[model samples]
Target: MRRADEKDDDHVTELVSRAEQALDELIKDIEALVRLESPSSDLDALRRSADLVTEIGTRYLGVGPERIEIDGRPHLAWRLGDGPRRVIVLAHHDTVWPVGSWGDDPWSLVDGVIRGPGCFDMITGILQAMLGIRLLVEDGVDVDGLTLLVTADEEIGSPTSRALIESEAQGCTAAFVLEASGPGGALKTERKGTSNYFVNVVGRAAHAGLEPEKGVNAGVELAHQVLAINTLGDPDLGTTVTPTVLSAGTTTNTVPAKARISVDVRVRTIDEQQRVDEDFGRLHAVLPGAVLEVEGGPNRPPLQASASQDLFARAQELAAAAGLDALESIAVGGASDGNFTAGVGIPTLDGLGAVGGGAHADDEHVIVDRIPGRTALLAILIKDQLSA
Candidate 1:
């Protein structure tokens, strides 16, 4: 009798072989998507990609997608199947790069790698997902109970779409985020939570040249606050408190009463997040007349291992059966929509996109050869859940 691992590999091989047949068409679809620049903040540009996705979904899945507008930007949701147990396939269509930033031709294929704005970071994932689902649909795989959410503002912290994502994820069996895979194609099972804070200092203004002692220096108070914020970081615990953006003083000669600092906080757990929040709240301005005001907390909760391990185990088993290398999960400091689902106690698996690197960088690209296998893996994973 054959061993279980070998049997699993054979199953994966069959699925991958089927998906590999669609490689050329998948590349074409991905290229088409990358050419359409959909920066997160541009409503018009975002709609262009949104329309393209609608066209593709209608053509391949034989169904139309619902366009939901949040904060004036549109998001896409396509529900497949009618089963009671549903799976949430999470994706984002918007990218960080703005138009005209990638020179004339951002979309290009060279030496087995595809380079383009948002190609590796996500556009490729979206296309791959469509192709994967197409394979399942064509093979008559039962897929009557899945939800695909392609949001428009993920690059800007999902300010408007979080509620929609949470609502859709509610009652779903699991969530699979189409974020790019880790180095060597490892899946992400744990992710840090993101919390943003704005620290504003208010003080009385006076002429710098006259009565300097009477003017309360908000900039100095801000500096003190920055120092205190810096102390909140605990590297061993994977928690970081960074004051990313700073602004102070209206003019050069003025005493400069108002100052604002934007802080980015990443934590590995809710307790750690609470600890940092408490510390930030307890911070007091050093200047006697200066007052400190803090705003924002825990935008995306952490995807802890406790909430995601089961899904990760299942994915690893599926990967092994597919004849791929032994699958392992890693924790990343960056947060994704997966965090939101995992935060709600759902088993979530992430980083199931193309295998490559250079996300959000000038050299952003995805490995051309790896697309077929990854697509097959995702399709099988989705079918596995839907079948159950």
Candidate 2:
């Protein structure tokens, strides 16, 4: 075992050189994953994607992941090394792009850029992790107490994998999320917690052309609720309460008797999340004869900076040791499975994924040149943790 402080520069350079040598194979693995279109909504696609991931993981790590299925969706888990301390490498295989959205040719490599569905959003991160582990094993570094969990549903908010993530994160020393990097590849130290709500209104129906006054309008009640909900946002504290989707009415001749409002809530702190939850629970219908029903609260808790500060500091040290550019950390509004781990009181660091731009957009891509250095950095981070 190599100590982190002993011959640190040589160790960093050697790992980086090994990663560079494996760059071609890394790109090949990434292409294999990108070729498979695994949209979050498609179970069949997810299954195929899981199979491909299992194969690639086995080929690289010399071991297959255990397939943990939830609600017919397959999630992959690998428990490597059997040490006293445990850490998790959290990633997801699902992409936002639907099937056929990327057209016939989903894979492309041009001008040292690889473009495809799920390439930047996190496919490369998965591959990079595998390569990092492979490098660690080849160099005789102990990877015991490491768990790599590649979940199947993330693009749609990890409906099936949240509990599993929380369970796996318990008592772990650190969680490294393989989500896409922020602008300029900054590590994500903080992420706002998210909540989803559906406000339903029920009212009596009546003829719009005749006695519209007799009708208790659900649409009117929904409008009132939307206005009320909009007031809950605190811009100074970075809390946003947005009513995104709305629906009401039965026919053109009748007053709207049923309505629904989909609310999206984001908060930077648990206090704010609790405040919003209480505010939402107090919502009431202004119109007479309208009953309101609110469902769904706090999906993922905030990934607080406290959960990542130590890991971020250590990562900076590793980067410096590797002779790489200084690492930067950012707080993003987006949430990931990292939120679940962090919420469970685990130290979590995020955005240690592919360096690229335009995630979830048509031009989603990965910078081909950054792969080796990033992979090497990840390996070094993991080795440091294992050594400790």
What is the Cα-based lDDT of residue 173 in candidate 2? 86
Residue 362 miss distance in model 2 (angstroms) = 1.5
Q: What local lDDT score does residue 258 receive in model 2, on the 0 to 100 scale?
A: 96
lDDT of each: 0.86, 0.91
* Tens-digit lDDT string for candidate 1 (291-358): 98899887999999887788788877777656766787788988899899998877899999988898
Candidate 2: misplaced stretches above 4 Å? 1-6
* TM-scores for every predicted model: 0.96, 0.97
> Model 2, residue 107: what's the lDDT?
96
- What would the per-residue lDDT of candidate 2 be over residues 1-388, giving only the tens digit for each residue? 8876667888878888888899998898889888888999999999999999999999989999999999989999998966654889999999989888888889999999999999999999999999999999998888888999999998888999999999988878889898988888899999999999999999989999899999999999999999999999999999999999999998999999999999999999999999999998999889989999999999999999998999999999879867976899999998999999999999999999999989988889999888888888888888877777
The residue pairs found clashing in candidate 2 are 81-144
The numbered model that scores best in TM-score is: 2
Span of 10 residues, lowest total lDDT, candidate 2: 78-87
